[model samples]
Target: MFQLLIVDDEASVVDSLADTLPWHEIGISTVFKAYSGSEALELLKTNTIDIMMTDIRMPGLNGLELLALVRREWKRIKCILLSGHAEFSYAQQAIQHDAHEYLLKPISDGEVLDKVGNLVGILQRERDESRHYERVEKAFQEHLPKLQGDLLADLLQGVKISPERLGQKLESLKIAIPAEGRFALMLFRLEDRFAELDFYSLSLMEYAVVNMAEELFEDDFRLWSCKDLHGYLVFLVTIAGEGDTQQDRQEHPDRAAEPVESRLQSMASQLQLSVDRFLKGSVSVLISRWGSFPLDIKRLYEDILLSMRKQVGNQSGLLIYASDELEQLPVHALQRLYEPPMLVHLLESGDWEKTHDKLTGIWSELGAKWADSQEHLLEAFFSIYASFSSFAHKNGRQLTDMIGPHLSDVTGLTPSRSLEALQQWMFQSLELLQQCMENETRNDRENTVRRIKLFVQKHLVEDVSLQAIADYMYMHPVHVSRIFKLETGENLSDFVLRLKMEQAAFLLADPSLKNYEVALQLGYQNPNYFIKVFKKYYSLTPQEFRQKLEAVEEQ
Candidate 1:
């Protein structure tokens, strides 16, 4: 309900206007009457007003003074000025003071009510719009976490954001967590990739990691995960917990290193089941040395990443390692080893014989570097396939589909403990890959032809129909027509007409298809109109055409 106040020097005038106006019908349910601006100011102190009416010529404090006070203290309250004298000076003051309405001498109830009703509509619209804006803001705030998570995930993929712009966006997104004096970090690794190796494939596991990290931390932490430098998913966990050593003590003052180790083991045991249920993948955790916040976070994350590269000796998903376990495997080292004789050089020089022999040597070299099972053999495959996949996809083909089928089919050619077999597998895979490339190119052409056929069928009945099918497909109609005619060895319109006639001939023989049904089935909107076209094409009305076909069949 809108509260309204009426102020005039004459007590009877203020009361009469307030009582006579039927303000309730005009959306003002509560009313206050004041004989002067001073009295109205007092009333305003105790009451909230949506609209006000005052005499422009009130004694001592007039409507203009009251309007000024309202502007200062209650800017939302709308004002209307009343006056007995019809003076230009009074009207000028009302206009300057932002009075919503002005009426002279003995105002009728209906006129006042109409003016108030107009103001009420304006007030309601303003309120509704304000409410809508507030709701939209609240919803954006509520979903900030999920939005921030998605954004952080994209950022960690090495999607570029300049440093200054990065800081501004971080602030705006509310992920710029208070970097207190100290920070703690943890890197999580998903251990197994051979089960199904794919970057897009592990979206479920990444979601699980974010959820689990939230539950384990006390301090609010912003998280982002990426395939680490070692090719394992390293969760860069940065926490603004106090100095690590002090914070660890605060967490459990009585526990020694031995008990802490036991607790970590227990935490790992519980976490393994949860991770296994969701990921169907292996995992490992590397906790960073406690240090300062944000500044120390990147370095700590790198430590955890380095730890992921040093795979544990067992197949278990959970592995624990400190910085000591890390063995740097930067590409610069490989560049030094192959500067004079790079793999690309050997391959591009048409040294198939040399490249084949190099593969045999690398197989044993990798085996010696890690006397583990053939699991590490996959690391080489992943590296080679990654580069090859990029090259293939750039050339509009995928190498994985080519290599995967052959690997699945020919188990006899599989490499065991031998380098020669590995080379033979690589060479054989490439040969199969060539066939896949040809098939892919052929299939692309076939798909284009099929699409063109479908397009022609959809638009054949329309009068202004050249390239209508391609227009619907958002392609150049002429391009579609040219390609379609090239592939089918006929004009696009001829193909469309032939297809329409085939349907027409079928309808002519089928006794069940009514005339209107035949028209609709062949894409005509009007059955009578369709008959004219049918008669033109076949030299008979639709009914006559069908009857003639029947007569011929009977003969």
Candidate 2:
């Protein structure tokens, strides 16, 4: 809340001004009054005032003196001086001391209100900009620490986060959970509508979505949301009371599962329809089965993410992760099918022996952990997808692209046939992913060289700044400077100067051009400055250099 102060020696004028304006509606918390500048100074010392209104003709320590003091003490406070046009000199003095505006006396409450409203709007905008900057600065500060946390780690590893930090961040986000409960995850994502809602508005909408989801669950259950770090609303619901009881089944089990499931399913369907209808947006949702909890939240999150692999590019509907819904497969056998990036990284830099060692180490670790016909096969698949999906996504391919459409066509005999089909599918997917990774790596290297050459060549004739190069490449100027030094073994400024000097040498040899014309062509406004640079480069002034070249040509 912003405080507003009104100062006038006339009791009637001060009283009317203070009472007439609806302070709270205009976002002012308190209105202070002072008959003299002495009284106003006392009020200012004790209170936080955002705006001050004073009449220049106050009996003692008048508006001009108060404005001076305000500039010295409360320099941040905006001042509006009240004086008649006849006392225009006092208004002029007030402006010199940083008075916000000089208003004519006997002003109506309507005029007073309008000025105050405009001031408040300006103040509000300034405060909001500060807050947004604070958020961005805070995010950067916490980025590394948060990267060590479960969410990013799991997303990168294609596995779940550790249990502790999952609960911590969830609680911090104001999502409630019951002890020793079961949970199901539902991912609600708005496609291409991220920029439509700003941060604060999106935060509120996510809270509203969570509250609506909580309503569908019983009183025992509590729902919490972990926002999509990549982009979506991830909801975790803790099923209260006992487990999915037989009593629940006896009381029409399908209907029991049906209500909460159906509502979420309906939300998924209706949300997409509504987004398209109202916001020109689209949505997709992926739901998880009632996974046992006090159970790992990270695993549950991973399951939801894996369900998205099945979603592909579709806009609407819900996919539930269930034991029955999962095709029985040899996920454990396939787990060894793809080596993670650690081994891949060793391969990337042409560290052939280290790559071989890392590959062997990964297989050795997997050989002991993965056994034939592992019971929690789908859970293993979830972990694998969770680890790699984010990598695929960050580099531009969705999980669906990695897995391929063959995933949809396969279904067969109980465990073996399903396992072999899935095994082949996952292997094929990994192969496609490996190729994608290789292509991206090569492209990045090629692009880096291309961007550097383009940046240098584009600014060849001009005295290009590091900032200009960085802007052209869409990167930090310091980073561009550092990269230029690293790749070319010369500072950016030095490189550009050398290139320009070499070009200038060629231009100086052209007898048709005058020194100033050559300077202009070489991007120097001052010909004398160009001569100095030319002297530094060739150890001769432009005239001396041209004389030598002419002597050599004549000889």
lDDT value, residue 40 of candidate 2: 80
TM-score of 1: 0.32
Clashing pairs in 1: 191-282
Query: Which stretch of 10 consecutive residues in model 1 shows the poorest summed lDDT?
Result: 331-340
Please write out the lDDT profile of model 1 over residues 1-555, one tens digit for every residue: 688888887644654566445677778888776766876886688678888988888778878888888888887788888888889988897788788888887777778888878888888888878776887789989987666655544443333456677677668777644444444445565666634656666666666666775565433333444454344544444433323477666785544434434444455455667777766656766665655544555445555655555554444565564563333543211211122343445544545566555555555566456335455555555444454455456666555566675553434435533445555666676556556665875686578878767766665554324324655656555566667676778866567656876788787688998988888877767675567566656778878888788888899
Which stretches of candidate 1 lie above 4 Å from their native place?
A: 1-146, 154-159, 178-184, 189-212, 219-235, 240-283, 289-302, 317-321, 324-555
Residues 10-118, model 2: lDDT tens digits: 6446645774467888888878766668768866886799999998887769888888999999877888988875665775787699887788877977788888888
Quote each prediction's TM-score. 0.32, 0.34
lDDT values for all models:
0.62, 0.63
